[model samples]
Target: MLFPLFFMLMFPVECLTDLIEPITGGVCGIMTPEQYSEDLYMEDEILSSVSLSIKESGLNDVSIAPGYGRLLTMLATVSKAGSILEIGALGGYSGVCLARGMKEGGRLISLELKEDNAALARRNLELAGFGRGTEYMVGPALDSLKQLESRGERFDFFLIDADKENYPVYLEYAIRLAKPGAIIAGDNTLLRGRTLNPDKNGPSVLAMRKFNDMIATDERLISTMLPAYDGLALAVVK
Candidate 1:
């Protein structure tokens, strides 16, 4: 029981890291993991600015990995997403990244459970120049999703990074909330690579396996899972 809980919280089940084996581990070509991260962050002004805010605000453990932040920003920018929904708003780290890639006049709705975290995200988002285009909701994410559904809200892109146990349910809701071309990207799909080995079965692992299988098998979604930090599941609504 303890192991499962630890596994779930050990990494952001919301968004996985970029797949670099380790700083001293084998190569993914010629670059080390640390080097890859450095290259990606070299001229990344948006992340640099947001990271400074995160440090100053003491949102230390809340943001996504820098490499993953760049990936999220690229997904949003390349998709030209007009509306974005993020299931977790950890100090607004991922929110800032997602918002930076939004089309002009785009809006981002970030849902966080803790009011204090929500407040912190609001501040960080403001510092990142996304205060006007983002809304922070404080509540159980499922309740917030219901409210959004009631409001007839739809999104072009989704970033799921909340509880590991609820990932599949969130995937269901995300599919319902997405437009045809919408993209549903989930973090920590690898569950620390436990999803690949059945012997390592645990609640979180089982749940993630179910979620990944759903994405892969669902006829409505065309999906692929990338081997990033842990894993990233990208599914497009067909």
Candidate 2:
């Protein structure tokens, strides 16, 4: 009886997509509470294994973390990014998400300094059926990015998640290699929410604050920082 009632309620399931505006109140926010709850209903076993691997490797604390993974995927999908560049590929968790969102024939190039982490990321990408769409380059992001530039590679989307102190330099490189209308996203801009306090003296926090200030005043791009995991700064090149 309950199943019949539920089926009747959802008989016109196609209508839900059209109702998104009313359901979400036309606000540009992350997944709603309902959506989040629904996400918890479906679990990807490979993703679970990837998370466990990061934890077992003792790098969970310093890695991209969980919620940010979903955010990256959303960005790639919304932007319809066909060529993506990720400055950091900690354990491949985020890479999996980003790769999954790539348009058909799209590709993602991820940079990582640690061989072990890169290997793990490669495995994770393969597990997610994104092995062909994703490439892991082992080296400092700055060096790798320079090589990409030298090769005349331009990306439709850029994700910066490398060493915080080098964000300004990374931002410059990202801008240079990004095509007009490309989207650039930076992770950890909030530095654990310390960006608002101004009392933190750590180099990462300070660098993030300075980078934020620099981009905020730049005329070439329109940017905004979203209070997501840690924080995410997104800019669209004009």
Candidate 3:
């Protein structure tokens, strides 16, 4: 009985870390594994039930955790954002969050690479009643962003949460697309705790470090990194 209870107690912790590991690399300095798991589960439940048909598409796991979702909503509302851009549309979970906080007559353009993922995202958004407000572009983000730039499209808020290696390149494009005073946020900047140690030396970790250093030194934007959900970097375009 004692052994069984002990196993039960430890199981959730392992599960939570496993869930977050893909994004955070199991590095959460501010929150305990149990706390993170509990919080993430609650968040997942809320988003999962939002009438999004794609809710059952296994894309919810690709969405931002609850804490980051809330933050995105708040920021969109606070900025009175009418135009938004997202580099990644993984399952449309974050798209729903951003759309919910959008001002009246707001529009969001989300880019995704995989056709199946785009379709799933569309389904999710439609289910959430956010489909009308979002445009799902199925292709590489770089190509899509270039098209937007060519069309002279600009956004009030931008969120970057796509490929790890493309962060800096995304930053450049985001900077070009943003209006002055617009907020640009990048997810997973911490790369788990590997960034702090510096010795682990994975490609993602190295990319994050380079991006962090670049952001810190950049004069065009005011930037800060938050330790929320594997780490988020927030920058306000000047």
Candidate 4:
């Protein structure tokens, strides 16, 4: 049932290819990303408020796009994830999205590097009604991942959107801590399309390419990369 629902929700994304098939003068389909967000992607107004606050606070606008937020919610919901681990928490925008998909009593643990960022995330999550079931661990995410590993904590779903260079490590930790059949998702896997450039050999690009390869060839999981919105990599633990 969940798979069916997931596919139904993905119909729009699937049709996207054909939508721009007749690429007249290289223009994308009839809708821009903003238009798609406004028309097709349903976002919570609290998210709007969060975005505004982030801008007001002069914080880096690193939050996921609205359509991507909707994607996170749908993935979490369809996976029936009881426990979620988010590797990055930017003002709790993604946290709220994941929390909205949780079954009653589902737990969400977020690992953020900066104390200020985590603090803002906590406050925003509280405002979004997810404070009770969400946990925030500030400092390096790799350290937190190690701690979670030591504690033998397992998650039903994991979302990685942190530093690009550590993506492989994060993916490994996520797999190790994942429950069987757990879903592992990575945002920005395309690394702003640097992974596709033959000339760009930055550390981030190399790491992202390796991460994508692992997701594609790893025998322990079945995965696919959605080549939109900075690229979202999704895999299921075998």
Evaluated with lDDT, which candidate comes out highest? Answer: 4
lDDT tens readout by residue for model 3, 1-238: 6996676576556475664467543433456664666566565553766424445555545456667788899999999999999999887778888988888888999999989888877777787777788898889899999899999999999999898888888888988899999999888887757888857788878777888877777899999988856888899999
1-238 in candidate 1: lDDT tens per residue? 7996776566564322323234354333457664677676684665666667667766656466667777888989999999999999877778888998899999999999988788878887887788999998899999999999999999999999888889999999999999889988898888777889979888888889999999999999999988867788999998
Enumerate residue pairs that collide in model 4.
none
Point out the worst 10-residue segment of candidate 2 by lDDT: 20-29
lDDT for each residue of candidate 2 in 1-238, tens digit (9 for 90 to 100):
6996686576466654545546542234457653574468554787788878888888854656456666677878988999999888888877887887789899999999889989988988897889888888898888998899999999999888889999998999989999999988888888877888867878887888888987787888899987755788889988
Whole-model lDDT, model 2: 0.82
Error of 3 at 154 (Å): 0.2
TM-score of the candidate numbered 2? 0.79
**Any residue pairs clashing in model 2, and if so which?**
none
What C-alpha lDDT values do all the predictions have?
0.84, 0.82, 0.81, 0.86
How high is each candidate's TM-score? 0.81, 0.79, 0.79, 0.85
67-152: candidate 4 lDDT, tens digit per residue: 77887889889889899999999788889889989878999999999898889999989998989999999999999999999999
Each candidate: RMSD to true structure? 9.7, 11.2, 6.7, 10.5
| Ten residues in sequence with the least summed lDDT for candidate 3 | 20-29
RMSD of 2: 11.2
Per-candidate clashes, comma-separated: 4, 0, 0, 0
Best by TM-score: 4
Error of 3 at 42 (Å): 4.7
Local lDDT at 202 for model 3: 81
**Model 1: how far residue 57 lies from native, Å:** 6.2
